[model samples]
Target: MSEGSTGASVVPATVHLPDDRYIPVRTEDLVAALAREHDAFGELAPRLAHVGEALTRIVSAESGAFSRRIERAYAPFNPDRETVTVGDVGGDRAELAAILAYTFDKANYDLLEDTQVRAAIDSANVHGMKVRVDREKVEELQIFVRGRTQETRLVRTIRRPIVGEMREVELYRRLAVVFRMQNSVEVNIKLFRDIPVADLEALLPHAEAGMSNLDRIKILGGGIGAIGGATWKAAALLVSGTVIAGQYFWALIAGLVGLSVRSVLGYRRAKHLRSSQRTHHLYYQNIANNAGVLDLLVTSIGHEELKETLLAYALLLARGERIDGADALSRAVEAWIARRFHVTLDFDVADALESLDRLGLWADRATMRPLEPEPACARLEQHWRERTTEDYHARTLSQRG
Candidate 1:
């Protein structure tokens, strides 16, 4: 059996590959391995694949990987026969919130089993108390969250439309969005405050719009096509080789081969032009036009999105800082939040820390003080620090010379 990618020493089962090599798969990886095998083999390969999957399921059940009773609980929500694996259902609050949000947003609220539905209700109530959601009108709740997702997409899309002097402005807007997710209202204000007064005014309405980035971009693209309709028609003739006579059928065939390529290029050019014009128009808008842009941007972002985004960033930052054990890291983060955002943060640090371990960001404990960084990550960190120090020395020497 070949060892799994996780590189854990434990070998629960051996899988004989098409090659002579046998892969040693851990108990937790049994179901996954069976799935990979099922996908790799064609229908004519053998019924052995099915038997193997069934055996793996039996082993998983016997080893208490997941209870049959819990699988039954997930059945209603997963009518497509998709298994909502044990690891998926079991996660930290932020992860659970993301899963529940996605499930509800996709209009699957009523289909959720009792456990999942309860979890969703509890999370929405806790994170979004001010927003009222009727059990019957789960879609209404989804609409609110959906708007935030759209706005974020819009914020990211601004990069394509904007360039040059407004690049910093766009960065500020993005940082505002990120900081806002961390519930840092003051930081958002500070970010917006730094932007030019005219630019801020121009950005306000576009940012506040309920339309997503893709939707707005499509609208602009359509407008561009209308204006440049003649150009497109001429290009289509060139691309289609419809102008060529029957005697030159080979030319027509060549045109057909390049048809898709031409269409793609035409679409790209039209999109770029549309984005440029739209951003230019926005750049020239009057400052008086958007009086409440700041408030609009702030209110549009949802609580759950902010928390999830912040948690992800916080975990990444913790890894970079090489923060010590769960307890120490939690205190450091809580203090950082208090200092930076000036807000009281109440969360389950242990669960968050456990999630880091599950993600392979945190190394398993050997002794106290977070142990030494795992060699895999430690080498990279050391290289970066050394490079930074060398750069600093070179810069000082250059200035002195």
Candidate 2:
């Protein structure tokens, strides 16, 4: 209860990832859960239903950009020339795409140029052939895309760390702590349970957050290779072959080196990536449950317009920290919510405070102080130190070593 810091952010002696720590978030389960919330939609119910339906369609869609690329760009480069293999017709979409890419790379690099690869590409380019993808492969790719996209959407809508109006240095310190936690026990459920309920209570915004940074890196690597190769070929073609020795050689070498560095960076960036599907699923379910609680709080003590604002404040209060005294905190939270969700909502502080008081989130009658984490939440944080993934991996490695 002291005003001082929480003991310089102690680093645990060990970290451990639970053996069954991550469970895959099944897309079907998410759909089922979303479907259950349909009747609870009220005025926005129809719109929500439409989004869910769109999700279904997207996940079920057969071909993707990669699939189309395989069909359009490389399918004609098939070596056999026995039949016109449009897209992934031979059930080797992935391999064929890779080979086609390698062929293009060889053309640009002019290194170990395979005669057969050149012949195939030249044939395809002239013949104007397209590729066909296997139905099963297309389905697999779709599912992967859907899973990645949904997790991205969930994080975009939620998973934000809310900050109080502390000093700039203090704010950076808090953010540093958040970054560290994100790397360590943030993956664990105990730590998740320890997160302030208020942050979790805002529910998800409708928009999808787009592909994650890691996924974007993967795309970047491929894009660089493809674009760089094409650029080199185009530039070389513009110059005469008689003068190709000086300018062409230097350009090709420099471009290849640049492409190699980017590819390595993208690959290295990918190594630190951890899938958040399980965490997103857990948070998704939490949002649904919290929605019911917020609804009850609204019905009991809040106005129709004040429902979301009250919910946000209640979450902040229950989250185990006070931003300001009751009156000031209430006003600040209302203003922030109005601005944060301005397009979708209007703000109301009076009813929101009343709701918070009714819900026991208000610290005391007069001062309206912030409440500390519940005993259960404190216990969860304590438990995380003893059950960290770092400890688990260390022990396993020691045994194996």
TM-score of each: 0.20, 0.18
What's model 1's lDDT at 62?
A: 24
In angstroms, the error of model 1 at 353 is 1.4
Lowest summed-lDDT stretch of 10 residues in model 2? Answer: 142-151
Which TM-score value belongs to model 2?
0.18
Q: Between which residue pairs do clashes occur in model 1?
A: 1-22, 1-23, 1-24, 2-22, 2-23, 2-24, 181-306
Q: Count steric clashes of candidate 2.
A: 19
lDDT of each: 0.30, 0.30
lDDT of 2 at 172: 9
Please, what are the lDDT tens digits per residue for candidate 2 over residues 1-401? Answer: 01221111111112111111111223334334333434332243233333333323322221132234333433343332355545554344454434333322211111112332222222110001111222221111100000000011111111231222221110000000001121221110011222211122111121112234435656676968676775778566656565655666677667777777876676555433322332353353332121222222222221231232223333353332454444555444444434433422223345445434433433454655423335323332433334422132123223543
What are the C-alpha RMSDs, in order, of all predicted structures? 26.9, 27.2
Per-residue lDDT, model 2, residue 370, is 29
What is the Cα-based lDDT of residue 380 in candidate 2?
28
Model 1 lDDT, residue 142, Cα: 16
RMSD of 2: 27.2
